[model samples]
Target: MDNNKLIEYLETFGALTSKDKLCLIDNVEFKAYKAGDVFLHTGKIANQVGFIIEGVFRYFFYDGQGNEITSYFMSENQFVTNITSFNEYTFSSGTIAAETDCLVLIIDRKGWELFAEQIENWNSIISKITSKTLLEKTNFQRRLINQDAKASYLSLLEQNPSIINRVPQTHIASFLGITKFSLSRIRNQIANK
Candidate 1:
């Protein structure tokens, strides 16, 4: 598995000693998911964390009406895991599915635990990664709360222009808290402008 992307992403949070990097590389497994394949299902424990090498994933949950509501998207270089569920050994409340065919490097709970004992800076590096992930998630949610659907969609485009091409319109609409019709209108309006 070419995990240079994974190593480079980790480097953004903090330095990884040679031993630390080697240990992480040894512990990870390379996995691929076809578009629409579930990475983590609701009601199942998230026993692994994935570092995306290619493609996108959507985090979603069912509403009271049994409609799937997309809450987040994770693309290349992002970590995909239900942080609380992974850390506390609890079932996930949402599902994570590949929005595009994806290649990822995975570290199971056992491998992660081994790193804590074997690697010197494992906890610090992981803490930084976790903090950064949570912060981004919170900020996105906050922005959604403050913005209308069109604004939210536009913001998403500004941040990740390729996402419009990568994810289905339905999923993007759900993520923006709008209907497919509304999204179409928004896109048309933007195009006209």
Candidate 2:
């Protein structure tokens, strides 16, 4: 498997020695998922985490009303996992599914544990990654809560310019907490402006 992208992303958190990087590479198995394939189903335990080398995944769950709600999108270079489920061996509250054909590097819980045990600074690296991921998700939620549909869509475009083209309109609408028709109208209004 090509590991250059993974290595580059890891470098952003901290300096990794050649041996450290090699160890990480050794523990991972590359996998492919078709669009719409679910990685972690809601209420299932997440036994693995994936690093996206290509494409997008959506984190979503069904509401009490049975409507699917998109909580977040994970794209290239991002790690995809239900953190709680993966860490605590509990059930995931949301499902993670591919939004497009995807390539990922997977490390199962066993491999992850082994990696952590072998790497001295692995915990510190994970801490930084976790902090950044939490901050981004929190910021996304904060922005959505304060914005109207149009404003939320605009903000999404500003943050993820290619998402509109890369992901399905229905998923995008769900993510913005708007009906698909409303999102269409918003897009039309923006185009006319």
Candidate 3:
């Protein structure tokens, strides 16, 4: 991962001093994952948080029936982790899996704490990130409760067209809380219209 790109990405959140930027850079460790790899698993302690340097990952939950429900996708320049697990040092209830080959910048909880202690501006940045994640999750849950599968699929398509091509249709369907057959029919209907 290019350090310049990572610095540029961080700059978007807020302006940082040279010292602050260097401190941020010191905490990050780059990692790569192959397609079909599980970046995180449910019921495991999540020790690290990741910033996507490239590619995509799906965050999901599996039901007792072995059905998957995708919560969201994290792509280039996005941060992701099981928040509860990351913050509380508890087991995760959701899994994050690589949807494609990926490059990520990982910071362990200790690294994050060290950075937070040293960077005065980091608290505000962290708050903004958490707020946005919460808002997105809430909005998604609202949409799922109020809209049909077709509507949900359309929403996902509108927001992340790249995911339609990068992720499997079955996974997309699961994300939208619909059966594969239903999603196929919906896609066909939309295509014909």
Candidate 4:
């Protein structure tokens, strides 16, 4: 909800001083969104990144038939951005929307550039961020390639049990590459065990 939280997240990579926190306060602003609000829409360019202070967001894309296919969900304390659009300055291919009423710390491209220039060990922090993001992506890819739907769902349950409580079944199904009906079946099976 504040720079303190952002600074705390930043500290996970390394030590940061009070000065770093203050700099973040100067560079980032807080924004609030109501449930179902569009944070970033497909075809729009995303110039800012957000740190989720509270609530959930889903990354999704519409199919040719206009059905939404959710790619992932991001929860509290995580960063959300269109990586490709931000890096290449292209239109975003996916949409990010608020799954619940939310509060986020936002930093625009210019702010991030300035913050990186001013913050100590900023490159190291960027390296650390890149590593963490890649690890998450790799794990997601691994699950898609190597795990069955039931196994994937179980792994998610093990790592983030609260996800079932936080996001809708359809979104969870999409993330696990299953249908809502299949998710219900999986939950029933797990419950019976």
Candidate No. with top lDDT = 2
The lDDT of model 3 is: 0.84
lDDT agreement with native, every candidate: 0.90, 0.91, 0.84, 0.85
Error of 2 at 84 (Å): 0.6
The pairs that clash in candidate 2 are none
True-structure RMSD, every candidate: 1.2, 1.0, 1.6, 1.6
Residue-wise lDDT of candidate 4 within 144-167, one digit each (tens)?
A: 779888988888888777667788
User: Against the true structure, what is each candidate's TM-score?
Assistant: 0.95, 0.96, 0.92, 0.92
lDDT of 3 by residue, 19-119 (tens): 88788788888899998899889899888988888889998898889877887888887786888898888998998999999988888888899878988
When 1 and 4 are scored with lDDT, the better candidate is: 1
**RMSD versus native structure for model 2:** 1.0
Residues 5-67 of candidate 2: C-alpha lDDT, one tens digit per residue: 987887888888888888988889999999999999999999998999999999999999999
Runs in model 4 lying further than 4 Å from the true structure: none
Regarding lDDT, does 2 or 3 come out ahead?
Answer: 2
Candidate 1 lDDT over 29-64, as tens digits, reads: 999999989999999999999999999999999999
Q: Give Cα distance to truth, residue 89, candidate 3, Å.
A: 0.7
Model 4 lDDT-worst window of ten: 1-10
